[model samples]
Target: MALGWWGRQPVAVLATAVVVSAAPILSPAAGDRLIGDTLPVEAADALDVITPVPSSLGADPDRVALGRMLFSDTRLSRRGDRACISCHDIRSNGASAVARNLTTDGTPVPRNTPTAFNAALSFRLGWAGDIPTLHDQAELALTRPEFLGGSWPRILDTVHGDPVLAALFQAAYGHAADREAVIDAINSFERSLLTPDSRFDRWLRGDVHAITQAERAGYALFRGIGCAACHQGANVGGNLFEKVGIFVTIPNRSAEVLRVPSLRNVAVTAPYFDDGGVATLPEAVRLMARAQLGRELTASQTASIVAFLGTLTGSFEGRPLTASRASGTAQPGDTP
Candidate 1:
């Protein structure tokens, strides 16, 4: 246990932690420990690292369909080559998967583009926790010169020119191409981007076969070493701000603190962190362990934890959220 310096009662927490950290009691065919390790009710109640996705996020079909078109319409950009789809593409796990998204002119954006999947579940929006809602974030992104570089007039002009899109908006909101209706439609579509039914979630719901023994061990270690303090709640994070290097210094950005990201779909959202500085799961595991927890994990341990993270990959619209992992995903020890 990493409880020594953290003001925890070593003997008490460790004893219970041991039972909670152990492997299943028997073989799966025999149905013993079918749902894996059993923790004390108290211990279980104290943690919030895992939460099941809401079965229904309450999306309006009309708004979603209209938002789908708006999300892809490049005319929303000043350059006509960018749109909401440029960075937060639904086909790519709602992230562009780049170190930093760039403008049409190739200038770099300020920070990594977060995935839109499950974003509505987040308590606050943006890496800085600056934006309050998905609707507001969409508006800022649309108008910001650094992002979509669009104004209401320029975008409304484009929307008014498109008879099909204009009619769709009119039908959905009793009017054509207004700022409020536009953002509302986009927000509705984003609400439907929740990726549910991950293996971890299935395990949470009492399925024994959802994850492997090593993955379970990794989860135990994750709690034992205290990685879940900030990364808790339904989203698994996106609840608060966290310093990047609480235990160790990260050069160039050691002093900056930002909002913690939700790890629900982390296995597929590669090029991690605010700057997208890390590339592989294994590498990120090692660095975060050292920097955040003051722990140095072995490759075997890292692999196990990373394996647990893989079970976080969930499905969207009845398919894998991202197309990049269609062939296969990077294993624990594979190259980035």
Candidate 2:
């Protein structure tokens, strides 16, 4: 295969940076334990590549509770028919399982809804990586015509009218529900959505029995093939941006450069890719390998990688995340 742009960059440079940057955040005592004589050489090597997600982001509890209620309230939408939960169903998959979701006016959303779990750990918000913070993301969703289509004034008016919501806002923010307060509450809840303690995380912390031999082999393959170059760090991929098809090409990709998505709970949040066109995890893995690494993985290699990915599924609020049955009602016209 010809060397693409990805070939020009040294994988070790980014990989080393990711590991070094994690030192201050990741527990040093735990790091010593992971690299100590207790673990196998492979497990210790894996620790230098990807650190475990932190257990908490330390968001405000009152704000988190307020955001939780506001998340489900339909009044936030222009037509009072949708909430943030409409596309991002936190109860099911943190995202819509379909490729895309329809807007309130029936227009299909341009990109797939990425999972809400562990998004706080990512560097930027959205697949484009244009939005800086969860607060901005929430604000965009609230006002964007393609999303909730509601203006701030109207949203605040509704909030002011509702005694229940107003009181909750007062308790959370110590003031009335203004634009900043509303967005801040939602952002607080989003920061609280971290999914920690996956099997892979346990393995990272030196629990040799957390994953099977086959899964460990899969992790080796995942790293050996250079997937870890971009998909490394606490979120396992969200720390940076990269083009999807560095070597080959992915058909129907809407964007070239994208924010590398977090692999946390990835097994549950499918169909894959920004378009959500890929239906299965194995297919997505194969497509990514060929496109990004310029390698056609054998069946066993694909299965092993898939198995390793399954170990990434973590608990949200003390319960395991499952694939959403009500993935999306929208068809594949322009939505998934």
Candidate 3:
């Protein structure tokens, strides 16, 4: 049982939400032998940094239910044609398969659309660490001219105006559509978007058969080459804000320091990096190895690491998430 931001602590102190891992599975022959029998005591201690995903969210069912519909409802958008789903697609790892997210105001969003899945578990929100919580992010995104281009009053009118939405919001919040209530419902629903039970998560939970030997080797390589220094938690890399070009120079430098993204579902969310410039995972991995770790990996090492990353792709609403575009390094044919 992995614990995310919801299970660890209440959202009142969500900024400091740190995860506590579940008890490790005590198996030898089933999952990756990275622990219990195979890994030494010191090596196992290193794994303490990584945790498993929680099974469920700590939110009101009614509010979460309402939030789910609101998340995809274009009616909530300013133009009534570009809702949250226009940028954050649930079917595609909680993000649109594009570099820059589009807005209804005919202007491109300034930053890449980070995955909303398991986002509550992050220490800080947004690429620049500007937003504090999911609720704040929601409120800001709703009104940004380059985003939904919506105002709370206008959104409240839309929600209260529509008979269906009004009923849902009233049922969930015991009140008509309002800013606080709407944001709360959306926040609650976003908390429910955790993608747990990945193969790596299963392995962490003590199932040796969950991941393959190659993936285990890749995990070893991921840490062995120091990739896990920043990417070392339940969400993997969202905990820290580190400089992008620490080791080597990358093409077209943007910001010096950036909020690290979770590597939990990195395989499927391609055209990687803050700017979404890197198109393929292998290319991104190779670039990261050079830029972040000062290590040059061979093709086999990159492939193995990518294989391990594929294990990070988890399911949503009981359906497993598959590779979106075929242009990435780890595709459907790649073993998990």
Candidate 4:
């Protein structure tokens, strides 16, 4: 019997059933052959595991606009120095380039900052999957001294003090600024940050030419080797909590159980894993295969998987997301 990624969760058994049952069967024999490295999967089968990102998650336009302004508003921070965009740069990959972000005193934070793009799609908030909602996450960030560090009274006063923000809040919420309304507006903007229409999504939607042969094969390997057990669904990995190093021991400083990250814009959001120790996409693929699946993949196999992951990069504002030129490519022999 195949145990799930999390020993107690039985995710593999249940998720595999969901995947198999959701797809329409054109030919039972054909589906068998598609699991290997040659043929493309039937579109019907692909939709069962990974669905396309919707253009919108139905956020109110006024809330989104107000939230967009607040996302960059430094007054949200106690020092009036940092903003949400300081770390989650919407202009780039929606994450910090460094392995971790610095606190007010310039000491590094414990974990790598995950991208803000498509974050609302995750079943839970934060790396540990502890926070229940986007509102809670925002509240934590606002109050945590090492993070935004603003007190509730001070934050409310700061917001009400600014004429522009006060007017925007009045227009959006029909009242003066409050903690809940501020967090709610920020959540609305974050929900609007979904990156959709990736090449892989197009392929899943029946555009055969959207992805290359190698990518299709890599996707086959991805599922065949059990990456999909934890990384399936519309956001491609955020729907479940799984422990790292299920097969091999990978070091982690935080809780062993982590919310699987979304692969929506993963190619561009480099410096991967919770620690951000892995530098390249290829390296991350190789490491995860050994750590999670107990498989030591060859260099070519890693490349194919990397190519497939590249297709997961999605568009924001009709423009394709990109990363730094020297983010580093996968080198052979790098393992967990």
Candidate 5:
């Protein structure tokens, strides 16, 4: 008797399911055990922050303006095709709708693009926790060969050649645009992407009518079942890193390492997880419950949590416009 297609598989799906279901509870180290120590209690106090939301960096008006332009500039990429918004779209919860977007040459990048909403609050940046600050992360992305694929000199040239960009940079930085100023401006704008006026935040701020009964119940279940341990901070999960399969490895290549993502605007950002394997919110909940909690969630529990997560969606104020090159548009030899 020959093995069928299903039988030829190395791991049984049901067995893998069992492992994911038992992993979270059985292994105490699966989630962020450092939640109590790392996330400051001050994060919960909305009034302390100047913007009424949790932020890890300071905001400067000029820097944010510069960042906004760079974020939308396609010239930042080596092939002049990709921008910060290419992967992390501000319209779609700050993440791309597809599993992954292509590089300038159309090569598929691995891993789902994480949301930029409230990303400044994360203790670490990127799916691997590789970059610590927004500025560093921006610089890495801009200079990475596989990513933007452009050198600093070329990027500076492209930006400086654009008139609209040059004017914007001048207004924002109070001088001619430079490489460091460009990076700082983008970082500042990113810092302003924090979203904290969700119904959950309102409820936490003593608004009894902010969230629905179902959402409230879901919040209780989230904490009661220990989901809150890692996903409790202002952004609701960006403050920590966690391995995907703790007690048992899920039958997937990308299961080993993952940064716990912020659940803010989770309703809009589908195809969950770093791999973008799970398609729906309910499936994401089920997968997370099984993988992180080691418990099978009831249908109602999943529904309520989904309802609560839906409240995290926020609105963006303005649309970024494409600007002209800064070089010929500005006065000669005006480089900062």
Candidate 6:
């Protein structure tokens, strides 16, 4: 069976029959081929690609300072209402739990806001892998219709108009405010958001006492039941793309394919998956096991894995209350 993030399975033969009858002939046939294979050797190779977390690209003192300022700057938005940190909140786990954050006009966005914590480690950015790097993603977040809904030229104009911001831009990049420097500073700040001191990291570094016995058992079960087929490595996931349902049928939304998310700090970033359909962590665990593993897990097993996941949470390193140019009392979405 194809493994999922958690080890639950579709009901039983009855569930299998229902899936087979409803599924297109090709899907079940493909699933059977996948199941017959003995844990694709590529799975191990996938794990090998994961490397220890790296320092942020623009983590120098000046760049980080500029990026932090830009991150919370509300003027980057069209309505002067949303900042990058609005959705990618520094205090939270880099995301809000809501299905989507409201736009300046209160139009609900189409997808959940993904956490920015450890985003620099992602092989690809965004749920659909639409953007390529932190720089590109930051640009999209500023200009995407569903996001800040502004243009690059307007962004440059706003940054240059702010005397404090322009000075900071000069300090960070040795030039006055412009789009390139803005993205560089923002990306630099984002790069600094890495969190690697979790209990799992300690365990990897030979501190056996870092994690609990139950967590260790859950980690074992995670591999034993095939959850690691897609969720392996330092990030524990986000390295590869996988169909949502490998052994069973999954409800599809507009975009059918999704990149696996990193398990780091997953405990606080709730309402899981690309759609944010599943509300609780346990339900997500159960659903994943059923949909991917083609095997059922005991409640105890699910609880243990959840316990291990809790250990993934770590501290947010960015400063929350930094000065910005011409900022009054800032609301949730306001740009700097």
Backbone clashes under 3 angstroms, per model: 0, 1, 10, 0, 15, 13
Candidate numbers sorted by lDDT from highest down: 2, 4, 3, 1, 6, 5
- Could you give candidate 1's per-residue lDDT for residues 163-264 as a string of tens digits? 898889889988878889888888888887878898888888889789887777667656655566655555766766678788988756755678778887
Q: Write the per-residue lDDT of candidate 6 for residues 1-336, one digit (tens) a residue.
A: 011212232123223233322222223233332221232222322222223444344478788888888788777788877788777766656776576677667787777877877777666777876665677888888888778878888889888888888888887778887778887788777877877667766666668798876676665555546676666455667656667777777666432667777877777777788777887888888888988777666788789778877877666553321111122123654443
Compute the lDDT of residue 197 as modeled in candidate 6: 64
- Taken over the whole model, the C-alpha lDDT of each candidate is 0.70, 0.76, 0.71, 0.74, 0.62, 0.65
Candidate 2, residue 5: how far the Cα is off, in Å: 26
lDDT by residue (tens digit), candidate 4, 1-336: 001122344356356645643333334454455544432354424534677887888889999988888888777787878777777777677776778877756678788888888887777767777877787888887888767788899889988998988998999888998888999898888888878899999988889899987788778667655677777667777767778778888765433888888887888888898778988888898888888878898898788778888899998888888772232221112110
Best model number under lDDT: 2
TM-score of each: 0.82, 0.85, 0.83, 0.85, 0.75, 0.78
State how far residue 225 of model 6 sits from its true place (Å): 1.1
Residue 16 lDDT, candidate 2, scale 0-100:
68
Tens digit per residue, CA lDDT, model 3, 74-121: 656677666675666666667657788655656556777787788888
Off by over 4 Å in 1: 1-48, 323-336
Q: Which run of 10 residues does model 2 get worst, by summed lDDT? A: 1-10
Query: How far in Å is the alpha carbon of 93 misplaced in model 1?
Result: 1.6
**Model 2 lDDT per residue over 203-248, tens place:** 8898989999788777766766667767876777777788878888
Q: Quantify how close model 2 is to the true structure by its C-alpha RMSD in Å.
A: 8.2
Off by over 4 Å in 6: 1-58, 252-255, 318-330, 333-336
